[model samples]
Target: MSEQAAPLRRERRTFALGLLAGVFGLLLVPTCTSCGGADESQAETRPLVLSTIGQIHDIASTLAGDDLRTEVLLGAGLDPHTHRPTRADAARLTAADLVLENGLHLEALLHATLDARRASARPVVAVGESIPAEQRLAVGGAGALADDPHLWMDPVLWAEVARAVARELSDLAPAAAPDIARRLEGVLAELAELDAYARRSIDSIPAERRLLVTAHDAFGYFGRRYGIEVASVQGISTESEASVRHVQELVNLLVEREVPAIFVESSVSVRGPRALVEGAAARGHQVVVAGELYSDSMGPPGTYRGTYVGMLDHNITLITRALGGDAPAAGLRDRL
Candidate 1:
C-alpha cells in the first residue's frame, strides 16, 4: 500500500480484528443492558449505543425517544480537552454500534481514543463534520481548536449536528429512521423558536452592556451568533490556565469599563473566576456572578435547560436579564 493507503488499511485491519473478537467472545453479552431497569427500559426500539460527548448524548436521547443506550465518556463537568479515556470507556467503545464523535476537535483527545477501539463494523460518525460551512466559525488564535469545536453554542448549527447524529444512528439501525427523523424535526422547530426568542430578548439589551466575559473561550460560537463581545480569562481548554498578565489585564478592564457582572460555567472550575471577582472587589469594583451558565454540559434531566435547546434558552434568559435585558420565563414554555 502507498503511504496514505497504509494507515487506511491498518484502520480497516484493526476494525476487522475487533469484529472478530465480538463475533467469538462473550464481550457483547450485555451486562450493563438494563441500566437498572426492565428490558424495554434498557433497550429502545433500536438500542443506538453511543460513545461520545454528553451534549450529543443528550440530543440523541431526546431525538431517539426510547432509552437509546447512550454512555457518555466525557461526562458533565468533565472537560474533553483533557479527558483521557479509562478502561471503562474502552468497553463502551467496543459495544457501540455507532460511535458518535462530536467531529469538531471539541473532543480533541477523544478522536484517537475511540478510533483505537475500532468497533467491529460500527461507524465512528463525526456528526459535526456534516455541519455546513456557512454556519461554522473559527476558533480564536493559533491552536488545535483553531476551527471552533463548540458549535453547539449556535442552535441552528446544533440542529444540523443533531440531524446528522440522528441520521447516522438511523443508518446504524434503519428500522428507527422515521421515528428519529420525526423527533429531530420537532427539536429543530423548537430550536428555531428559541433562536427567535433569544434574538428578541437580547436585542433589548444595550450594546454597551453586551459584553460577556465567561470562564473560557467556549462561547466563541455563541458570541459570534448573538453579536456580543466575548472574552474569557482562560483560553479554549480549561486545562490551560490564565496567565498572571491576562488576569491583571481583565481586572483592569473590569475596573475601567465598570463591567458589572461576569458569568461562570457549569463544567469548568470556578476558582479562576472567583479570583477575578475578588480582584475587582479589591479595586473597589464589584462584579457579580450573574448566574451559572451551562457550558460543556447541560443541567440534570427534566429541567428546562437539560437539552441543547433548553440550555441555550436558559442562558439567553440569564444573560439578558442580568445584563439589563428582559426574557420572560413564559417565553419558552411556562411563566417566568
Candidate 2:
C-alpha cells in the first residue's frame, strides 16, 4: 500500500471499531426499570438535555436556565475526536429528552449511537449545523469539502449556536419558551461582547507576531474571526497523527517568522507543541509554549473558565499576553 493509503485505512478501521462499539453499547442498554432506563415520570417532570461536549452544554445551560436540566457527556480534558460511547453514555443518550451535538463530525465516534437515537424518533440536534454554510470554514484541502466542527472557537458563530439551542429548548418545553427567549437575548449580547473583546485583544498584538501555532487545527474559526494566522501540528481532527514533514514545515515557519510563542490545547497532547519548541530551539529561535488553550473541552464545571464566555476570555487574554499584546490580566470581565 502507498504511504497515504496506510493512514486512510487505519482511520477507516478505527471508525469501524468505534461504530461497532457504539452499536454494541446500544444493544447492551439496560432494559430493566431498576437499571436506570428512561423514567417517563421523571422525564415529564423535567426535560433532560444531553450535550455531547462541554461547549454545547454551556450554551444549552445558559439558554435553559432553571427551566431545563442540562448535562455534558464529555468532560474537561477529554478529546471528543477519539471518545467512544460507553454503556452508561448509551443509556443517557437513550433517555435524554433532547440531545445537542456539535456535529460536523466532531463527535465522530458517537455518530452511530446518535443516529440510532434519531432513528428512534428522539430529538437530537446538531447545533453547529445551524450556522450558515458560508459562515463555516471548509477543510480537507483540495479534496472533498468538509465543514470544520470547531465553530465554538469563534464567539460570533457560537452565538448562532446559542440561538439554535434556545429554539430547541423552547420546542422541547413550550412552557419555558418565554424564559428561554429572555435568556437567549442575554447570551447573545454576551457573545457579541466576547467577539468584540477577542478582536480588540488580538489586534493589540504586533501584526508580524500575531500567528497562533497549536497542537491541532482547532482554531481556524478563531483566527479567521480575530485576524490572526493559525497553524497547527496536527490536522483539524486529533484522530490524525502529526506528520514529521508537517512538523518540520511548522518549525521552518517558526524560525523564519521568529514567532515568539506557541500554544498547547487542554484536551490535546502537548508532545506536538513541545516538539515544535524543541525544533525551534535547535534552530536557535527560542520559542515558548505560551499557555494551554481550551480547544475540544472547557475547564472544570462550576468554575469561571468552565463557562463559554470564560473559556473564550481565557483564550483571548492568554494569547494576547503571550504574543506581546495588551489585555487585562483578569480578562474581559475580571473573571479570568
Candidate 3:
C-alpha cells in the first residue's frame, strides 16, 4: 500500500459501559475490524462492518442484531456535514466489505472520501435512495440546505432506510439475509407504532400549541408528518449560520405568537433559542426551555431517549406536555 493507502494502526479500546450507560467519550468511533485472531465465535464473517453515522448505525444494529458488525463512522454529537475522515477512518473503510450513508446530501464531506476509494471497495450504500420522493421533505434554499437531508427524522421514512440497509448488508453477506429479513419486519412494525404514538401525542395538544421551535431545521419531515409547525433558527446543515435578521424575525414571532416553549438541540449551541426566550421575556411573553431534543443525534446510551424509538418517544412526551397536551401512562405504541 502507498502512503495514501499504507498499513492501518488501531486505537486502544478505551471505553467500557458506564453510569446510566452514558458514553464518556464524546467522539468515540468503533474503528477496528476483526484481525481474524479472536475466538472462532467472533470469527464469523460480520459484513465487514456496516458503517454509517450514529442514529442509522443504532437503528440498523437493533434490526440486524448479531448478524452484522456495526461501526458508527461519526461520533454521537459531531456535525455530519463538516465531519472529516481521519486516517483511521479511511482504514476502516478500506477494510470493510461495505459502507452505509444517509446520502441525501447529508454526509457531504464523506462523499469525497467514498468517491476516492469506491473503485477498490465492496460497496457504498446510500440508504436514502429508496425513499419515495413525495414522502420525503423537498429541498429549499441554498448551499447544503438546498436539499433536505434530514429524512430520518420521520419514523415512517426511516423504515425505508432500514429496508435499504438490510438489502445492502444481505448482498454483501448472503448468509445473514434470512436473519436480516426477519428482524426487518419487526423493525418496520416498531417504527409504525412510533409514528402513531407521535401523531396521537401531537394531536392531543391543542392546535394552537402544536408549534415546534428548535435550534436547527432538522424537523421538516417530522412537522409535516404530524401537525406541528416547525421553526428552526438555523438551516438543516449545522454549517449554516442564522442571520441577525433571522434571529430578530424569530424573536418577533415568539413574542407576537406567544409560543409556550422553544427547544434546544444537544448537538448545537442554545444561544440562538435562548435569545428568542429573552426576546420574548423583554416583551412580557414568556417562553420556557421545553426539552433537549435529539435533532441530529441520539441521547446517552440506556437513557429513555438513546435509541431511535426512545428518542422520538422522549420528544413526543416533552412536546405534548410542554405544549399543554396530555400523555397516557404509556403511549399506545404497539409493535406489530
> Largest lDDT belongs to which candidate?
2
What is the lDDT for 223 in model 1?
83
Candidate 2: which pairs clash? none
Query: Which of candidates 1 and 2 reaches a greater TM-score?
Result: 2
Q: Which consecutive 10 residues in model 2 have the weakest lDDT in total?
A: 30-39
- Report the lDDT tens digits of candidate 1 across residue range 1-336: 579999999999999999999876665455545444576664455464674777788777777676355656666667777778777877777767667877667777776666675534556877877877666776656564356678888887788787887777787667777888888888888879978887888788887878888898888877877888888888887778898889888888878877788999988888878888999999999999998988877777556676666788788888888888877855466522
| All candidates: CA RMSD (Å) | 17.3, 18.8, 14.7
Q: Write the per-residue lDDT of candidate 3 for residues 1-336, one digit (tens) a residue.
A: 566433332122222334324653432333222333455656576665655677788767776687777777776677777778789888887777777888888888778778876776557877777886666676665563354778778898888888888887788668878988998899999899889888888899888777889998999989988878999888778777889899888888777766799899888888888888887888888999987887777777656566778778777777787888886544344211
The 10-residue segment of model 3 with minimum total lDDT is 7-16
Tens digit per residue, CA lDDT, model 2, 256-329: 98899999999888899999999999998999998999999999888999988999899999999999999999
Clashes of each: 4, 0, 0
When summed lDDT is taken over every stretch of 10 residues in candidate 1, the lowest stretch is 27-36
Residue 46 displacement (Å), model 2: 1.3
Q: Which predicted model would earn the best TM-score?
A: 2
What candidate 3 gets wrong by more than 4 Å, as runs, is 1-44, 142-145, 302-304, 328-336
